[model samples]
Target: MSEATPPADAGNTVSVAVSALDLGALLCSRVCHDVISPVGAIVNGIEVLEDEGAADMREVALDLIAKSARQASARLQFTRLAFGAAGSAGARLDLGDAEQVVRQVLEDDRTKIEWSLPRELLPKNRVKLLLNLVLLAGTTIPRGGVIRVAGVGEGDGMGFVLTSTGTNARIPAGIEALAGGAVPQGGLDAHSVQPFYAGMLARDCGLPLRFALDGDTATLTAA
Candidate 1:
């Protein structure tokens, strides 16, 4: 028998690839999270209509149906951002989409923001990264507080930082380590659970992530 050699690309293992897939799966889970409530309401409303059978309450049933459809539509618009399949490739995201993305995650009544970011000065890839980071921050504040978004306009690249402060927030330990680039060794569980996308984006953009954390302060700097 003749000896055979391994392929050249065989040496390229699947660490980050597996992580990326896991991230995608996590994003899909979020999409379901955003959609299921509205979808269930729609189903329930239809059941109510069947029971009503052309009574005056039918109008109420129709209203519920309309509200459910609107919910689905809002979820669709939000998902285009939270899980849209446009990674890098020179895709530029304006401030409009970026705001929508972050606000979508933080829109619930739990928290409010005191933003001070450039309304329109980020690329799509960067926005995607920031969205992930902001989502991490938002998860920290169950009772809500102030989110300060500040940026410095460099000649070519802009540096942006996000800081969140609240009364009853204990920044999740997973995000704390991830922001410092000392995230857990696990792959997607680290990245997907934390803000690994921001770290990846900073690398892709040839920038560094500067993290400073204290008792109740967390700041993420992208240069």
Candidate 2:
């Protein structure tokens, strides 16, 4: 499904027209969107109990709220690498570390994940690319199934292959095209959200996000 309507022009930018800073902002906001939900909810919850005085049930409510807020923030951070502009090269990046980070965040959810990879860190760009790739793969299934993830690292950089196999594997339209290059230019066209995010993130990181769609599964990868 198409992601929520992006917030104004900051969210939509043609490949050529988009700048690094713009892409950075887009990534930052996408990160914010996921994080703010639980954090904001927690804050509001706190104000409610604090102002009203902790009722008998306040302890349980506060505990659940706190746990959920932490989970949401962790997930959002993992998603930043996976779906948003993660980081640049020359910085410390561990694919295995990232994988664990993501899996830890996702484990709290109902989705059952099957993972395969060596304990190693990849370059910044490849890590970011794979994270986004996994996010896309996860979106394809609701009931959930096995996600086979394979990674290889070399002198130039690292590469990853993520396959989410399950019934009703419908990949998002926008992300499918983003792997090649450039989404068509327009004023917030219908199929212009995921691709934009993918494209912009790739551009910002100076990497490519490519989709390899074969039958029921899609693979996203880059260096």
Evaluated with TM-score, which candidate comes out highest? 2
Task: Indicate the TM-score of model 2.
Answer: 0.72
- Residue 3, model 1, lDDT: 15
TM-score versus the correct structure, for each prediction: 0.70, 0.72
Q: Across residues 4-83, which tens digit of lDDT does each residue of candidate 2 receive?
A: 22224333334455565655566566666667777877876787677656587587778868886877878766866665
- Candidate 2: residue pairs that collide: 82-131, 82-132, 94-121, 95-121, 179-210
Q: RMSD in Å for candidate 1, one decimal?
A: 10.6
What lDDT does candidate 2 reach at residue 154? 57
Top candidate (lDDT): 1
Q: Write the per-residue lDDT of candidate 1 for residues 1-223, one digit (tens) a residue.
A: 1211222333322333335667677767666777888888888778878884667777787898898887787767656654575556666666666676566456656666656665674666666666665766676566687677766564337767777677655545444334434434444452344365556666776667755555466566676
Question: How does residue 43 of candidate 2 score in lDDT?
Answer: 76
Model 1 TM-score is 0.70
